[model samples]
Target chain A: MPYMDKRNAARLVNDYADMIMRIGLMYLKQTYDAEDICQEVFIKLMSAELTFEDREHEKAWIIRTTINTCKDRKKLAFYRYWSGEPKEELVSGDDFTGNDLLEEIKKLAKWQRVAIYLYYYEEYSTAEIAMLTGRTKSSVQKDLSRGRKFLKNILESEYGKDYGFEKGGADYAE
Target chain B: MQNREKIKKAFSGVHFSEMEKSLMTDRISEASLFAKERTGKNNMKMKRWQRVAMIVAGVLVLGGTVGAAAGTDMIRSWSNSFSDFKTAGKISQKASELGMNSFPDEIAGFEYSGGNTVHNTGEDEAGNSTGDWDELEAEYKNEDGKSIYISQSPVVEGKDDQQHTDEVVIDGTTVLYDCDEYLFLPPDMEGKTDQKLLDREASDDHFFISYGSDEPETKFFKNASFVIGDIRYLIFSYDEVSEDELISVVRELIQK
Candidate 1:
C-alpha cells in the first residue's frame, strides 16, 4: 500500500501549500522555482513512510524538507548552469515585485533572507529556525541579528528616521 | 511587532492559485502510484538477481581462480560509485585513509568548496558486492560564483557512457570532452513530454529552448574527463568557460 493516498496528499497540500510556496520564494527568489519546489515537496511527502507525533511535528518536517529541497535544487549542475546569472527582478509576482520590505530582504544573503523570513513572517523562534535550517543556534541568532539590523538601516533610511522597529522583541545573547 | 505584521502581510499575498494547487495534487497522486509500481518491480528483480548470484558464487568457489579475477574487477569498478560530502576536508581525509591522491585546495581561479567520494565494492548489475576501492572529488568556486568540479577515480576499464564531442592529448593522456544536458519539465507536464523532443540531442551553445505547448526545458553543461596514471579525472564547469580553458585547467592539475 502507498504511504500517502491521494486524499491524504490533497489534504496535506491544502494545509501547507502557501507556507511551502513562501519559504521556497524566500530561499530561491523565483516564482517558477518556488512552484516547482512545492510540487517536489508534496511528492516526497506522498512517498515517505514517516509518522509524525503531532501536527507541529509534521509541520516542522515539511518546513525542513522544503528548505533542504531548495538547497539541493540550487546545487544541481543544470540549475547553476542555466540560472547562474542573478535576475534583475527576483520574483515575478506583482505582490512581491512592488513590496519595499521584501525587496530589501531579497538583497540580503540567501541564509540571512531565509532566517529573517522564518523569524518574522513564520514567527519561528531563533532556536526553532536553527533546528529547521540544520545550523547552530548561535549561527541562526547571528543571521537574525545581522539581517534585522541591515533591514532596519535600509528601511529607516528610505522611509524616515521615525521608521523604527518595535522595542522588546526576541532577546539575543549578542 | 509592526515589522513582523508587515512581513507576514507581504508574504500572505504570495501563493498559488486554486487551479495550480489542484494540478499539483493530481501530479503528486500519479507520481506516487508510479513509484509504488516501480518499487514492487525492483523488489522482484532483486530476488531474481540474488538467486543468480548464489549460483555464480558456487561456481567461482569450485573453480579456485576467483580471487585474482575478483581483485582486479574490484579495483576497476570503484570509478562508478559516488557519495557526497559537506566539505573538502572530509573528501581529503577519505582519500588519505584510502591511500588515494588528494585534491588541490585551489585550481585556476576557483577555491576549494566541497565534494564527494566514489566507492566500488565489485558489485555488478546483478548486485554482488566484493572487494573495495575509492575515488575522490573536490568542488571549487571563483569570485564570480562560477563552479568547477574535479573528481579522481580508478581508471575505468570499458568505454564511457557519454558521447564525447572532442579529444585532446595532454602530456600522453587522452582527454575527452562532452556537454551534459539536463531537462527540467514542469510538474503540470509530467509524463507529457513529446517523444521527439525528449529524444532530441541538446545543442552545445543554446541554453534555453522553449517548445511551444507544454514541453520540457533543456540546460547544457560542458565537462572534460581523462585518465592520468591509474586515476580518471573529470572537470566540469557550470559557467560558459571555453573548452580551451577547461583543457588549461586540466593541464594545471597534471602539472601539480
Candidate 2:
C-alpha cells in the first residue's frame, strides 16, 4: 500500500504537478495564482494524515483536492490580479484551434475562450469539463455551444468559404 | 487527423520547461524517517493484520493492559500534565456526523498531553464536555519572556488543519504544550522577566530536550518547543543555540 511508504505521497505530488497546474490555470486564469494553488495542494497532501491505498488513490485525491481548492479560492474575497497584466489577456486556447480556429476564437470573451479550449483542445467530455471547471452540465453545454458558434462565425468571416470554417469546426468538436 | 495535428503542434509551442523535475528524493527519505519515528516497527506490523485476527489480538492485548494497570498507578507519575479537552469534543462530533464513528485516537501530534503538542496528561480524553477547539488559540510567553501565539488551523474539506493533535493546556494564565512550533520563539529574552529566572535556575536538572526539522523547499531548521516551568517554552527554532544559551535565557525568565 502507498501508506506503507509516506514518500510515495510526495512523489505523487511531483507526478501530477503539471496536470494539476494546468487544470487550475484554466479555471483561475493567472499563472502565479495557479502556481500558488499547486503548492498549497502539495503542502496539504504532504501534511495530510491520510494514507492512501496506492498511486491511483493519491492521484485522485490530488485532483479532487485541486478542484476543491479552486472552489474554496473562488469563495474567498480577493482575486488580487497582479498589477500590469492586461484585463483582456488571453490564456492559451491552443487546444481548440489550428491557426485558423485559434485566430478566430481569440475574439471570444475570456471565459468563453477557455470553454472552447477545454472542449476542443483538452478533449474533455462535457461532464469532465464541467467537473474540472466547476460549471453545471447545462452551463457547460451552453458555453460549449456558444463558444462553438463564436468560433464558427469568426472563421466564416475570415475564410469566406464554409469549407475552411467547417474543417476548423471539426477540429474543435468533442 | 488534421485537427489532432494542429492541437499537438500548438501544445508543443506552449513553452513548458524542459520538464525539470524536483529532486525530492531527500524529502521522501526524510518523510520515511518521520513515519518511522511516530509508528514503531511493531505498530506497523499490527496494522497489517486482517480483521478477525486483528480484533481478537487487540482485545487480548488491551485486556492484558487492563490487568497490569489494575495493580499499577499510571496516573500518579505526572500530576501536572495538561491536555486539550476542547478539541476532542469537536473531532468526536464531526466523526459521528460522518458515520466514521471514530474518536480518531490521534490527529497527528496533538494526541494526549505529553503525547503530541502540549504533553498534557492523558486523562482529558476520558473526561467531560468542552467547546470547539477548532478556533481556539491563546497568547503566552515562552521561556525567553517573548510573546507567542498558537491555535488550531482552520478546517477546509480534505485538508488537515495542521493542528498538533497532542493536547494543549490553556489555564488562561499560561499556554503549555508540545506543538512542533512550540519549539519556536522570538529572539532572546524580550518582554520576559520570570521566564529568564526559570531558564537560569532550571538548567542543571530539569528536563532538557531538542527537536529540529528542516524544510526541503527552502533550507530551514526548525526546533521543537522547549519546556520551561513544565510548559512548552517558545524559543527561536532555526537559530543555533549553544547548550548554555537557552538554559541561561530561560533561567532569567524563571527568576521572576
Q: Give the Cα lDDT of each candidate.
A: 0.58, 0.37
Q: What share of the true interface contacts does candidate 2 keep?
A: 0.14
lDDT of 2 by residue, B106-138 (tens): 222213211112111111122211111122222
**TM-scores, one per candidate:** 0.47, 0.44
**Can you tell me which runs of candidate 2 are displaced by over 4 Å?**
A1-15, A43-62, A83-117, A131-134, A150-169, A172-174, B1-5, B8-20, B24-256
Candidate 1 Cα outliers beyond 4 Å, as residue runs: A1-3, A81-98, A161-163, A166-174, B33-256
Please count the clashing residue pairs in each candidate, in the order shown. 0, 43
User: lDDT of candidate 2 vs native?
Assistant: 0.37
Q: What DockQ does each prediction reach against the true complex?
A: 0.20, 0.16
State the lDDT at A152 in candidate 1.
Answer: 74
Q: Per-residue alpha-carbon lDDT of model 1 for B118-198, expressed as tens digits? A: 333343323233444455656687788876668666654432333357888878878877654445456555456666654
Error of 1 at B228 (Å): 34
TM-score of 2: 0.44
Chain B TM-score for all candidates, comma-separated: 0.56, 0.23
